[model samples]
Target: MTARALSARSLLRWLSLLALAAGCHVAPIAAQELIAHPSAEIATLTRNEARLYFTLRLKTWPNGRLAKVFVLPDNHPIHQRFTNEILGLYPYQLRRVWDRQIFSGTGQAPITVDDEQEMIQRVATTPGAIGYAAVPNEHPDLRVLQVR
Candidate 1:
């Protein structure tokens, strides 16, 4: 490679690295403060806890009342990620499990809702219920559970 060409490439590489570092440094400060906000104080859940909570595998709350769950549509990316991250299963696998439960007549799968507002409304009205959303809706009756 020619000397001038090599020097130009090196300068570009250094500039890219510096820009990346600056971006990395700036991004976390905003995220950290947002996460620390008072209303966002819901507890972080373990993978198992999140799974059981959402799947209704934990049929009842610690208080013994039957637990209900609400979920977003299967096609949604966030729902897919939530299922994979919490249950260690894809949406199809989770749906199959629910299908089996329906066939067995032992228990029902959690209800799936169209959007966060509907989910929040359902969970708020239903006793021992849980659901998730990007930003929680303003509902006096609903409780938002935090998952780390």
Candidate 2:
């Protein structure tokens, strides 16, 4: 083959490999659902409202009951996915908000659970509690909130 043709072929091969490598590093966001205690009384929330709840800004349910927020650890995969997909924020940004609230004495961070199982359990039992987790069909006591 001609030298020019050989160079173009090599360049195309490298670009293809580069694209594949980049694709492999991109992790797909998992399906996450917003779950709450059966008694929470909230059926739907806007994405902004959900962000407020998780960030500890919205303190009370619409019915005036205190809103108890639960969350998985900051580094957990589900937590990351929920923050990115539902809340449209990075995990560290959420953490910064929580830490600032905790340090300023004006707010309290959400209760952090160790895993999705614990998240489901806490939200199920805590009155007015809300959290996010993988599709929670196994637990009938948890209410899946619709996020607009």
Candidate 3:
């Protein structure tokens, strides 16, 4: 091949490597944002507290309202992210908790939504609903619960 063609190829390879390296350096945002109906009694929760609610251990809100938990399908990446970051557990671990609850006649599984949009919609409209998704603008009908 000609020297000019070889130089162009090398330059292209360097540029592509630079682009991939830059992408790898980007700081990742939070994996999930906790959201709830605007009127939910609780505003913040520690990781363990959130874990209890999510795992079906604490079924009622502080105000005695039943806590309606919503989640995405288990295979979804967001589900995995939320399970890791917020619940401090794996999706399979949470599934096992739910399964045990159902089989033991002690509790039920959470409501499952299709996507982030549906997750937000259900939590925003249901009185005692709680769910998580990508960070979103503060909506009048929804409250973003700070994870302590």
Q: For model 1, give the RMSD to the true fold.
A: 11.1
- How far out, in Å, is residue 39 in model 2? 1.7
Instruction: Tell me the lDDT of candidate 2.
Output: 0.83
Candidate 3: which pairs clash?
A: none
Best by TM-score: 2
Better of 1 and 2 by lDDT: 2
Instruction: Compute the lDDT of residue 14 as modeled in candidate 3.
Output: 78
Better of 1 and 3 by TM-score: 3
Residue 108 lDDT, candidate 3, scale 0-100: 91
* Model 1 ranges off by over 4 Å: 1-44, 136-138
lDDT string, candidate 3, 15-39, tens digits: 7678788885422246368888765
lDDT tens digits by residue: candidate 2, 1-148: 3686568658856776787888854222365789888777888999899998898888888888898999988999888889877887889999999999999998899998898888888888888999988764568788888887
Residue lDDT tens for model 1, 8-87: 65885677688797885322211111011123223455657667665556665555666666788899865775665445
Candidates 1 and 2 compared by TM-score, better number: 2
Quality of model 1 by C-alpha lDDT: 0.60
lDDT, model 2, position 88: 73
TM accuracy, model 1? 0.61
